[model samples]
Each structure stands twice: as structure tokens, then as C-alpha cells.
Target: MDDVSSDKHPDRGGTRRILLAGPRSFCAGVERAIEIVERALQAHGAPVYVRKQIVHNISVVEDLAARGAVFVEELDEVPDGATVVFSAHGVSPAVREEAARRGLDVLDGTCPLVSKVHAKARRFADRGDTVVFVGHAGHEEVEGTLGEAPESMVLVETAEDVRRLTPEDAERVSYLTQTTLAVDETTEVLGALRERFPLLHEPPSEDICYATTNRQLALDAVVAESDLVLVVGSANSSNSVRLVELSQRQGTPAKLIDRAAEIRTEWLEGVRTVGLTAGASAPPALVDEVVAALGELGPVEVEERRITDETMHFELPSALRGTAGSRTSGGQS
Candidate 1:
């Protein structure tokens, strides 16, 4: 991570001010998910099989892998009766059934918020309403949610998709969304849905998780004042990518980098104030490394712009609750 060289940006010698977004990285759900793996390792020993990446961050996955958590794409990879932890993104009912058939000791890491959305899908579909799901296609979270009521649900990625929808009964339609999404764009899609289906039943509350919402709201406070914005997260992270897009939508040049070494010298040219933020799944240590590397290039002044304080906390799964090293914290776990 110490690949940042001062010689690369010699011409840009000055005090670089970095505005850090508060409530940026490691949300409560992510914390809970990670702790589940760690405690499982302690309770059940090494080689604890995990169904997915757990969360979207590569660093978190790699760290857990080093500590004996084996991540697999499917249940077949695990030996029968071995311990398996589900990723934070809820699994479909079919996946649950498969795990049960394998007789695996399952430890569910699904975020409470995502579980709520899944329950809504079942309820809406049972009521004979066609559920319109709003989220990106091919995403694991979307796939899991859609599976809850596949026959009774349809997915729409944009306002145009909503326009093209021709349900069996247009009047008997309800809508749900993936937990991670761009808030503004979702609103636009919802507006189009309302125009097309005046009686479209909406979710009881916003589907977008509080951590994702807080990170975006915090970034909004600093993006306009920044010459460039850098979001720290892996490419596959939907919430992290959305942060970069949010800055770009506001006419500011933004880039997504997993670490400080990925920062380009050209981005620093004539740039003074830089806005720094991390996705909900990213580790805070990565953010610290970025700031330290930036300081090595020249003087750095870091100011944290806090829009709101996030005190949300999720409890660990019951299977690992009483295990050693299972303590929780108010901050990132």
C-alpha cells in the first residue's frame, strides 16, 4: 500500500485538503456479518465455509480467508455436515433448502434490513399483487429477493423498464427494492411507476439501508466543495460505485479505488481540495492508509464533514453469540 511516490506529483506541491465523510465505512450489518465469520472460526475451528463474499469488500473477504473462512459460490463446495455461514445478502429459500438437505451447520449472516425486504416480497406476492422489484440485474441481493416470489415478481432497472411493464393486472401491483441503490435514481423510477400505475402499492418504509443513505448524505456535504472525489471500495460493491456516480452526477470528477496505490497522479494535477469517503463495506484502515499516502506527497489537511451520527448496531447470529471473542462495538467491528 506504500506505493504512493512524491516524485509522481512534484508539480502539485501544496497543502492538499481532504474532506472525510462521516458514517462512511463498515455499517452495522457489515460488522455483524464479519463478526459471525470470526466467531464461527473460534467456535467451530478453521475451514468454516461461507456461501458468498460475505460482504462486497475484497479486503474483508481476504482477511476472513486468511483467518480460516473458506468462501464458496455454492453449497456443493463444502463437505456435508460442515459449518457454513450465509453472506450478509440474504439467500433464497431454495438455497436454504439445499443447505438443510446437506445437513450443514448453518449460521445466517443476512442483514436484518435485507431480511425485511425479503419478507415484504413474500407478503406482497401472497396477496396476489405483482411485485415490482427495483435494483440492478445479476446482483446477488436482487437475485435473492426476487427468488422469494419469482412467479409473482418482475424486475425493472430504470424508468423505461417501468414504462414497458405489462403485468397481468396493472392495478394489482406492489413494489420493493434492493437494499443498496442510488436514492435519487430510485425516486425517479418510483415517480415513473406512479405515473403508469396510480395504485402501485409501495413498501411500508424505504428499502435502501441506513448506512448506504448516511454515506451518500455525508458525501453530498463535501463533494461540491471538492476539486476531486475518491471513493474507496472494490468495483463490485454497488454502494461504493454509487458514491462515485453521485459525485460525477454533481459535475465533480470522481474515481473509485480500492486502495491508495490505485490513485493516479493526473487526478491530483491542479487539485487542492479532495473529498474522501469509503463504501459501507470498506474497512476504515484503508481510508487511513489513503490519507497517509496523500500526506507523503505533500501536506494534507483532513476535515471530517459529518451530516449525521450513525449509532445503528446489529446483533450477531445466535449460534455464535456466546462464543469467545464475540464482543461488539459501537463503531466498525
Candidate 2:
């Protein structure tokens, strides 16, 4: 971890500054979730069983791992009565009940936005509408959304998935999406849904949040102007991975780095204009360290390319009943 130290800047004097990414770091949901984990680690100590990547970034998981958090994919992997976190992507009702049945101290990190989609999917299915969920199959978000009405919701990853799906009740069909999905991808899926089911019912509120859309737009705007873009996130982070793909899709070569140490000097060869952005679960400190590393390589000039402002906040779950505080340092949604 010392590899990402500020000393990597190589300046004789002090740290070099760069234009930081706006709307970078922890959203409200991420903050609360991280807080939940930290509090559990502090209060409980050692081997807190997190059912999935708490928020997707590998660095975050590693950091927590060092602090004695144990990540598991299923409840069976955890011993009975162990403390567990459900992940920011949310989980099915069955998972919730299972966690309870095992007597686990459960702290759900499900994003409110995702929970909304789950609710909508369940409601749409209850209305007897053949629900078409637009998202990558097997994704945790999609799984949670599908769980809302698994009996009725049909999974579709691409436009072709929509075209091929033969809904049981086409006339009364409805659609929802995974929160962290790419805007263009969802648009393509939505377009196909429209063509296949002309009377398809759209959700009252768009499942994708403002943060995801804005980040992608910002990257698209910067990619054309930059020589190479460095995405500040982990490979496991879906949002971070998408940022790399988005830059590539925009014709800009990009790389995903969990820390400044991961940045290969070779990728910097002959590249002057470097764009840097972080995934929802990535910490701002890691982004700063990357810029510091770049300053060592050359005279760096940082610029912020922002598509919009983000001021949204989700309240802490009332299960604590507001008696406790919920806040985390930094990362994405």
C-alpha cells in the first residue's frame, strides 16, 4: 500500500496538485454502507462476513480485508451467527430471510435507487404485466431486481435480448434496469423494448440515477480531448469497469488502476493529455495519488470535465432508528 504513498510524486519539495474529478468519491448510499462495515469491524472486530463486494471496488475490499472483514458469496460460506453485510447492489427477500434465519447480524447496504427498482419490478409483476428487466444477466443488481418478481421478470442483456424475448403478456409488459448500467446500452435495450412491445409501460422514475449518467457523459467529453484516460477504480467494480469501456468506446485508450502503484510508466510514454476519473466505489485519495505519480513523470496540467453537478443524498436506514451516525470517507455509488 506504501507504493501509493504521496512520496511517489518525486518532487524535491512537496505534493503536486491536479484538477480533481468533480462528483467523484462516495455517494450517500456508499457512505452509509461503508460506515456500516467500519462500525461493524470496530464494534464487533475480526471476520465480519460481507456477502459480496460491499460496493464492488477491489481496493475497498482489500482495505476492509486487512481490517478483518471476510467477504463471502453465499450465506452458507459464513458460520452461523456471524455478522454480515448484504452489499450495495441489494439482495432478494429470500436472502434477507436466510440471513435472519441463520441469526446473522445483518447490515444491508442496498442502494436506495436499486431498492426502488426492486419495488417497481415487484409491483409491475403483481399487475400481471410480463416484466422485462433490462440489464446484464447474472449481475448482482439484475439478480436483485429479478428477485423482486423472479416468477415474472425476464432478463435481457442487449437489444437482441429484448427482440428475442416473447413475453407471455406483451400488451401489459413493463421494464426496469440495473442502476450502474451504461446509458447507451440501456438506451439500446429500451429501443428494442419499444419496437417489440409498442405499448410497453415505462417506470415512473428512470432506474438509472443521475450520477451514473453524468459520470459517463463527463468521460465522453474528456476522452476526445485527452491522449489517454486513467480510470481510478478496481476491475471488480462494475462502474469502474464501465468507465474504462466508455473511454475505449469513445476511441480513447484507457486503463483501470486500483492505486497509483498499478500505473505502468510505459502507458504514459508519448502521452501528454491524461484524463483521470474514478468509479463509484473508488476513493478520491487514490485519484490524487495517480495525479501525483503523473507529476513525477512530467509537468502535469490537470483539468476537470464535468457534465453536471451532483447534490443528491439518501438517508440512513431507520433500522438503526436514527440513533446512530452513518458516514464513510470516499468512493462511488
Candidate 3:
């Protein structure tokens, strides 16, 4: 990690400052998922087959790949009876059954929060409730959650979609959401649903995860004082992409990059104060790299503006607990 202290530094046009967002990098769920893969690799040895990218970050996948984590697009590619781990995004019941059928030693790295969504969906379906789920259509999280109650759940991506939905039993309808959706947009869709069905049921708690909500809130503060925002993450990460969109919507120029190399010099032509943040699945090391690159442009100053302190952590799955990685930090794991 970059050890540069948060101090003011001057540039040509104005003070060249970077407003770093706290709670910007890996969340507890992401940490737990990555640790699962690391522990599985240590316990079982190299060439461990992973069903998908352990998390959405390319660098994270690359790091594990170097350590012999074999990522495949599907279970079929994995040899029969080989040990396989699932991604942070939960998989469907069908996936679990298929793994069992193949005789693979399965170690699920799915975030516990995602697993909660699956359980809620299944419960709603069991009670004959038509579940209206809000999220991107093809997201892995959505795919897995939908699989829990395919026949009972209806997916809506926009407020207009909510208007068009016709649940089989209008009176017996409930709603769930993907954990990484933009809070404001989800609210608009939920509002539309409420108007149509006065008694619409909501999840026992907010469906959107706390980390996503906190990061967006932090971005709100960053954009307020930043001329340009650099969100460090990959394209496929829903929460990462949402951070870029949220900044753009707030009228601040923002770009999503997987690493420091993608930050174009043109974007920084006249920028003074830049906002630095990362997706939930991203590592702080990526943010450090970007900060180092920015320093090469000219003298750079960093100020960490925190929205909240995060003490939340998810324990490793029971099957893997009390093992070698019992107390490993996210970075070391």
C-alpha cells in the first residue's frame, strides 16, 4: 500500500488533491469469499478449480490464478470429483445439485448476504407469494436468486417495468432486490410497485447491502468537492459500475478503470481535486496503485473523507473455519 501521508500539494491550475473515500475497497463479504478460495487452495493444494471469478475484480482473479486457481465458465469444464469453489455471488439450487451429481468436492464462497436473498426468495415462493425482484437482468446474483423461485419471481429493471408486471396473484405479492443496485433507482421502482399494489410486501430488511449504500453515500460527498472521480474496478462489477454512474448523474465526470493504466491523461488535463474510490469487490492495493500513478502527473495531495466506519465481518464458512486462514486479513488471505 502507498504510504504517502494525507497532506496538501500544489499543482499548476490549483491544489492537486485526491479525496479518498473510506469504506471504498473490499467489504466483509468480499473478504470472506476470497479467503475461502485461498484456504481451499492451501488445504487441497494447487490447480483448484473455481466455477467463476472469486469476485468481480480482475486483479483479484489474476492473483489467485497465479497461485493455481483455475477459473472456468461452467462446472462441466471442471474434472469430475475435483474440488470446486463458487464465486462470491451465490449460485442456484440447480448448480448445487449439478456439483453434487458430478461428485465434486464443493466449497461455496458465496457471500452470506447473497445466500440470505436466496433463502428469502425460496420462502416467499413456498408460501405462494409472487416475488418482484429488482436488479440487472443477467447479473450472476440475479441469476442465482431467480433460480430460487423461477416460477414465482418477476424481474423488473426500471420503474416502467414495474408498471408492466402482472403478477399471478396481485394480492399476494412481495419484493426483493439485488444487493448491489443503486439505492435511488431501486427506490423509484419500489415506489412504482407500491402505487400499483398498496399492500406490497418488502424484505424483512432493506434488500440492498449496507456496503453498497455506504459507498454511494460516500461518493455523494466525494463528488461534491471533486472535479473528476476515478472509480477503481472492473466493467462486470455491478456495484462498481453503479459508482461511476452515480458520479456521472451527480454531474461530476467519472471513469471506471480496472487499474491505474486505464486512467487517461486527457481526463486529468485541467482537473484539480480528484475523487478516488473502489468497488466493494476491489482491493485497496488497486487504489494505492492509482494514487501512485496520479503522483507522477504532478504533486498530488490526499485527504480521506470517511462516511462511516465499517466493523462488519463475515466469518469463513463453518466447513472451513478453524483452519489455516482463521485470522487472515483480506489482503494476506
lDDT of 1 by residue, 86-189 (tens): 99988999999999998999999999999999999999999999999999999989999999999999999999999999999999999998888999989999
lDDT of 2 at 149: 79
**Residue range 1-333, candidate 3, lDDT tens digits:** 111132322444544788998879899899888898889888989989998788998988998898889999899999998999999998999999999999999999989889999999999999999999999999999999999989999999999998998888789999999999999888899999999999888788988999999999988877866778999989999999999999988878899999899989998876778999999988888888889999998888888889899999888878788778642323410
Ranking by TM-score: 1, 3, 2
**TM-score for each candidate, following the candidate numbering:** 0.94, 0.88, 0.94
Q: Could you give me the TM-score of model 3 versus the true structure?
A: 0.94
What are the lDDT figures for the candidates, one per model? 0.89, 0.77, 0.88
Q: Choose the strongest candidate by lDDT.
A: 1
Residue 194 displacement (Å), model 2: 0.4
Q: Ten residues in a row with the worst lDDT in model 3?
A: 1-10
Q: Give residue 24's error in model 1 in angstroms.
A: 0.3
Which regions in candidate 1 have their CA more than 4 angstroms from the true location? 1-13, 326-333
Q: Native-vs-model 3 lDDT?
A: 0.88
- Whole-model lDDT, model 2: 0.77
